[model samples]
Structure formats: structure tokens, C-alpha cells
Target: MKPKAPNVHEDGLLEYLEDIIGYKEKQNQLKDKLSERKKNMLKQNKITKILKINMENLLKIIRIATIFRGERTIRFDEQDLIDLKEELSRLERFLEIEENELKAIQESLKDMR
Candidate 1:
């Protein structure tokens, strides 16, 4: 005898299984996007922390320079001051770029929320 063909209930079950598989694929794609967003946010946070620490150091250096500038008795080396100024200038430029990038990342994160 020939085997029975698939019944209507069996066909319905197969269609439901295919739909569930499609839903799972969509769910995985969403999960991956969320994970990438979280990683980007973490990187932004790290950049902010680093920027804060460096900014504090720069401010302290500025204050010291201002204080020492008024002291006539102290023989501060001009060369050392120039070197420090150059280094500080470089750091300031780097910080400026980092701040802008962090701001953009923050805006994107806000939109996602």
C-alpha cells in the first residue's frame, strides 16, 4: 500500500515552524545590534574618563604656570616651560577631537534609548 500523504494539520504545523524560525532570525539580528551599541557606549565612557583626568592635570599645570610667572626670585627655566607648553597644546587638540566624538556617540545612544 502507498504511504499516506501529509495531512492538513501536519502542513499547518510545518508552516508554524517556519514562521517561528523566521522570528528567531529577526530576534538575533536585533540582539546583535543592541550588543554593538552597548560596546560603543562603553568606549565612549572610557574616553570621557580619560579626558577628565587629563583635563584636571592640564588645569593644574596652568595654575602653577600662572603662580610662578609672578615670582621674580624663582629662576624658572624658559626651555622647560616651552616644552611643557608644547606638550599641553598637543594634548588640548587631542582632547578637543575626543570630546566631539564622545558627543556624537552620546547623541546616537540617546536616539537609541
Candidate 2:
């Protein structure tokens, strides 16, 4: 009797290669998306840090204004107060925007995972 040819399909070589290729494609796509997200996150974090620093500076200015007035008549220049308030408001708005961006990036990362 002649010996039978080997059953190539039974060895699963082709199937394994196909799976590996598919997995590699998926990994590449995920890596690209992750890199983009990381860049965005870094940008947002930097903005947040800047806004926090500005807010702290505004608070320090307000404290100094209060300290400058020690008598019963504690008076601060209206324009100074207005400028400080405006700066604080701007910083708060910037912080909010950065926080939202960070949250969105986190959500996207979670979905990808």
C-alpha cells in the first residue's frame, strides 16, 4: 500500500498565519490611536497646569491687596479688583476646558481598551 500524503490543513499553519496578520494590524491601529491620545492628553495637561498657575497668582494678588489695607477702612482699587476677577474667571474657564478634554481622552482610551 502507498503511504498517504500529509494532511496540511490539519496542521493549522495557514490559519495561524492569518490570525497573526490580523492581530498585528489591530495592534498597529491601537498603537497609533494611543499615540494620538497621549499627545492630546499632554497638551491638555500642560494647559491645565498653566491655568492653575495663573489662578494661584491671582489669589496671591488678592491676598496682597487685602494685606495692604490694615485699618478699619479696608479699600482696594476698583480697577485692580476688576482685573483680578477677570483673570480668575479666564483661568477658571481655561481649567474647565482642559478638564473636559482630559475626560474625553480618558473615555476614548477606556473604550479602546
Top candidate when judged by TM-score against the true structure: 1
Name the lDDT of candidate 2: 0.62
Compared with the true structure, what per-residue lDDT tens digits does model 1 show for residues 27-106? 56666665676666567666656766665676567567768777533335444555656665666666567666656666
Against the correct fold, how does model 2 do in TM-score? 0.45
- Candidate 2 residue lDDT tens string, 1-113: 11332475453555466567795577567667667766765776676577667656766766776678653322455455567667657766765776676577567657745
| Local lDDT at 89 for model 2 | 72
